[model samples]
Target: MITLIAGGTGSVKIARGLSKTVDDLIVIPNIADNIWLHGLYICPDIDTITYGLAGVLDKGRGWGVKDDTFVFMEQMKKLGQDHWFTIGDKDLALHLVRTNFLNEGKSLSWVTEWIRKKLSVSTTIMPASDDHIETRVETQSGDMHIQEYWVKNGAELDISNIMYKGIESAKVNAKAVEFIKNSELIIIAPGNPISSIGPIISLPAIRKELESKKDNVVAISPLIGNKAVSGPASKYMQIMGIESSPFGIASYYRDIASNLVISEFDNEYENRIRMLGIHIYKTNIVMEQSQDEIILSNYILNIVNKA
Candidate 1:
């Protein structure tokens, strides 16, 4: 079985692409971006993967259900709610059910599995942890949740500190660890390394697991030519004093990954990444369309097949 660690839009793209050609795949998504707003628990990463695998993702918006209406959010704004975090009508239904289940004392992993089954998604999807592990970005204004920084502020603020709140006390899900331990191959999807994959690896147990199986791990760099294909990953990397390029990504994952897949545009840095003892897999990492995703997915699988 193949296990993937991913978060948000980019991860979901790879998940959807891999789902078309691969079975027995499990995705462990970052939950640090989750937030509680307007009395609902909004898990952006989980919803992204769920919607993507279910073939109901809003491709144009990159998140939320396709053709979803924001009437609920509009009504909330009229009723004097913040509504800064937009929640569409159809999208709210999933949150409503998930919130209800949580209120009834259901584990997040259980609720996630239930949602996956409901959506008829064959690819298994698991949240990194059932506990709260919010990603907080300390900016010039103040420390705020990841959504506040990414959406409300347009990620324009210079981050002074990027922290994973509640991670020290957070417990890694056993099922997620089990899948990782038994996987034939592990791939860290192209997403924000800090905000997306950071929370999961921050946990001692999960980090240890990855370190033990580092030889079989491969990571797809979110950066190409010192720029991100989407989102503010490049900005965060810069704030952390890490170079905003494929070489920076290699340094970040060097301890946990043996191979790093980079875009052909960043071919110049392949030898530089190899200097860090990481094998390089060069390809067109940008997923502008479904075809691109399929090609990349097949490329990664072929590499695994050879192993």
Candidate 2:
């Protein structure tokens, strides 16, 4: 069993690859990325995993379903609706089904499992918590939804603060906790610390439980050559007033994590990371495309085997 803290495109691919090999793979996707637009819920991170595992993902876009139509949005535009966040035709079906299940008072975790089951995905996908963990980004203009800040607007504003709304009340899924307790390893994928992995680790209990079993814990650095592989991870860290380096990220997770797997490009900082008394596994971290993903996955599995 593997308890994985997952977020974004890279995390989904890593989780999908691991699911094929691990006996019981449990994913706690960051719910802080959840948002409601035009009165419907959208979970980018969660659905990215689902769509990828189900083999319906748009390979080119690296997210959403393949051959998915956007006629819904086209119609919305004709009706004078502002389609800021574009949801494809087939993808809309998922949102509708999930929102309906949630409206019936089912927990978000339960709804997520149902979605995976309907799609016949083998991986055990779960939300970070059943509660609404919305990410609110305070910018120079005002507070905005995470998707608006990242997708619609391209992080054009200076981020004043990044908050996880409802996280204090968020509760981890029971199965996720059990997976962590019974896992042989805890592998944190390369993801944005501020907006991706941070939200899931924000829950105190999760942090406590993980720290208790830190011997098998390992994290992949999202940075290569002091820049992010994708997204605003470097810029986001700077705005959040954190340095963009493998060592700095190590400092952030030092309390709960025991080791880091940095990219080959960051060899110069390995000495600095060693100063923190944590072991480092150096390799190529960026999954430029699908082949890079497969290779990185195998490399990490080898490290796990060695451990």
Candidate 3:
């Protein structure tokens, strides 16, 4: 069994690929991105992970369905609707079901587990907390949901602060903490440094649990060539007065993660990261177009086992 901390497309790809190589796959998805829009409870990160693992993801955009029809959206547009987020018909069904369950007071963990199993997803996925922990970006312009800043505006504004709104009240699941403590290895996948992965680790128990098992924790860098391959990691790091380089990433994981892994192209920074007292591994880190995610996952598995 392998426990993965994940959010959005990139970590979803890692989780999907790793499932093929590991039995008892346990995914700790970011719960900070959940939103209630248009009377539907939408979980963008959860759906992305579930769809990607199911092999029905729209590869091009990394979200929504493959070649999914927007007829429903077109109809709404024709009716003068001004929806900010794009939700496909099939995708809306998922949100609707989720909303109904939540309205009935079911926990997010229960609903997500139920849906994943209904879709025949063999791997087990869970949220970091059933308690709400909304990620808010305090920008110079104003406050925005993490997704609105990262997706809607393309991270154009200057960010002043970033935080998980309700994380103080969130509790790390006992099972997740147990997995973290007793697992042979724990991997922090290359997701957004702030909005995605940060929120999951902010829970007091989770952070303390990760600290307790620092020896076996390994982090994969989301940045390559000093820029994030996807999302607003670079922007957030800069806002936090931190550099967005390989060494910068290693510094962030200093005490929490004992090992920091980089890509083959970033081999030059191997020694720089090592100076931070972090064990570094140089391998191909990008799951770019035409690259095999499974093969990449296998390489990562070997690294973790060796750690």
Candidate 4:
């Protein structure tokens, strides 16, 4: 089985492509971006991967169901509610269902599986943990949930720290850990290393498992040159005193990954990353269209197959 550690739009795009090529693909998505809003539980990364794999994602917006209406958001706005985090009518239905299930004392893994089967998704998508670990951003303004920092404030503030609340005491999902242990290859998908993939790997058990299987782990850099493909990954990296380049990405995953996949645009960092003892694979990593996603996925698969 191929296990992909996923979060954010970039990772979801990768998941979409891999789902087509591999039947035993398992996606372990980060739940740090989850939050409670409008009295409903929202899992951004999980839902994005689900919608994407189910072939109902809004490609243009990169999240939520395709052609979803915003009537619920509009109604919230009319009621003087803070609707900065845009939740469409269709998207709200998911949050409502998740919230109800959680309130009924169902484990997050169970709820997620139900949702996946309900959508007729064949690929396995699991949360990194069933625990309530939240990504909290510490900025000059004050601490706020990652959703507020990224969505409400547009991630404009310089962050001082990122805290994964509840991670210390949280248990890694046993099934996810089992998959990581038994998988033929483990891939760290291109996403925000700090907030997206960070929380999952921060767990002691999860990190230990990856460290044990370090040689089989491959990381796809979320960066092209010094800029991120999307989101505030570059900003977060810089704020945390790490260079926002392919070299920096190599350094960040040096201890956990044996190979690093970088964009051809970042060939200048090849020697620097190699100096850190990582095998580098240079290719056109940008997935601007569906064809690009497939090409990148096939490229990675070819590398693994040859190994």
Candidates' lDDT values, in order?
A: 0.90, 0.82, 0.82, 0.90
Per-prediction TM-score: 0.98, 0.95, 0.94, 0.98
lDDT of model 1, residue 296: 91
- Model 2 per-residue lDDT tens digits across residues 150-240: 8788778878889888888777766677777788888887778889899888887788788898767888888886688777778778878
**What's model 3's TM-score?**
0.94
* Native-to-model Cα distance after best TM-score fit, residue 6 in candidate 2, in Å: 0.5
Task: List clashing residue pairs in candidate 3.
Answer: 264-283
RMSD of each: 1.0, 1.4, 1.7, 0.9
User: Which regions of candidate 2 deviate over 4 angstroms?
Assistant: none
**Over 4 Å off, model 4:** none
Could you tell me how far off, in angstroms, the CA of residue 198 lies in candidate 2 after the best superposition? 0.6
What are the per-residue Cα lDDT tens digits for candidate 4 across 40-64?
Answer: 9999999999999999999899999
Worst 10 residues of 4 by lDDT: 231-240
Better of 3 and 4 by lDDT: 4
Clash pairs (backbone) in predicted model 2: 69-89
Give the CA lDDT, 0 to 100, for residue 198 in model 1: 84
TM-score result, candidate 1: 0.98
Give Cα distance to truth, residue 90, candidate 1, Å: 0.8
Q: Give candidate 3 misplaced runs (Cα > 4 Å).
A: 289-291
